[model samples]
Target: MEFMLDLAVSVVSLLVVGFYTWSLRGHFYSPKMATGAKLISAVVIATTLFFLYLAWYEHQVAWVQIVGLVIEICAAALFWWAVSASRKARLRFAFDPDHPDSIVTTGPYRYLRHPFYTSYLMFWSGWAIASSSTWAVVPVIAFVIIYVSAALGEEKKFSKSPLAPEYEAYRRKTGFLIPRFDQR
Candidate 1:
């Protein structure tokens, strides 16, 4: 019964991510992009799936699973919010030093420059916790490195856009992957 429950949770969680990602298909414009960024994005997907699979296969502590669920839900919510807000910017999912249609500074972007990446971070960390394996840390750390690289690379892309000045100011004032509590 416990196994069945874990399986169900895993299925639902994966479906949510899969379906949402699918829906984003043509929403983000794909300009001529960095090959390395594409590779990193692929790595993000691979690492995420591996960690999530581990989450279900490994024995999960009840409290940890609950905490994971909470974090995952929060992350999903933020993703949705960020996506909704990004529509105005013609948000693309990849890194293109030439593809800054607009610099989004409202909604989720107001608090964190990379709310989308934050969601990914939360989602993976939650999955790792849900896995309840100390070994899960490996993939979690990898995800962090990959996501940070992509985020920073994307920011560099933005710096080349028409909004470079504003983007620079935003970058200085906003947090990278987390909210800047220091903002006054």
Candidate 2:
């Protein structure tokens, strides 16, 4: 019974995220340039399923689970920050071969070149931790690897567009996921 419930929850969550991602796809990818996007979608679904399995069958919940949940919350906050920042820049996902007219540099982007990816990673990591299964960590690591690869692939595509130089400059200044503090 619990397994069934978990499966249903996982499916519903995936559907919601899938639809949301599909809608945003137009803003980020060009026509016929969806291969990378599709790959990312697959990774997300697979990783979600992996986490669900672990949550259902693996380890006991512990204090660390709470820590993981907290981390997940922080990740959600970061995701919101990215979305809001993107909106402020008036940039929609190009979803085309061409880059958007504006390259965002404010808000979370000021700290990380890819806040959206970072947020997604954080969310996934938190979810894994919250599952409190020893195996849950595997999916989290896999998701990170896949996401990074996909991000780099997308970056390669974007590099040829007008926004390339600007993005490169931003990348040089910001960490990909971690924020840098001036120790000096």
Per-residue alpha-carbon lDDT of model 1 for 85-162, expressed as tens digits? Answer: 887677765554564768888788888998887987888787677777888788778868877887887888778778
Model 1 deviation from the true structure expressed as Cα RMSD, one decimal place: 2.5
Give the whole-model CA lDDT for all candidates, comma-separated: 0.73, 0.64
Task: Supply the TM-score for candidate 2.
Answer: 0.72
Q: Which regions in candidate 1 have their CA more than 4 angstroms from the true location? A: 23-26, 32-34, 37-41, 181-183
Tell me model 2's lDDT, rounded to 2 decimals: 0.64
- Give the lDDT of residue 21 in candidate 1: 69
Residue 32 of candidate 2: its Cα lDDT? 58
Clashes of each: 0, 11
Where does candidate 1 have its weakest 10-residue lDDT segment?
A: 19-28
Model 1 TM-score is 0.84
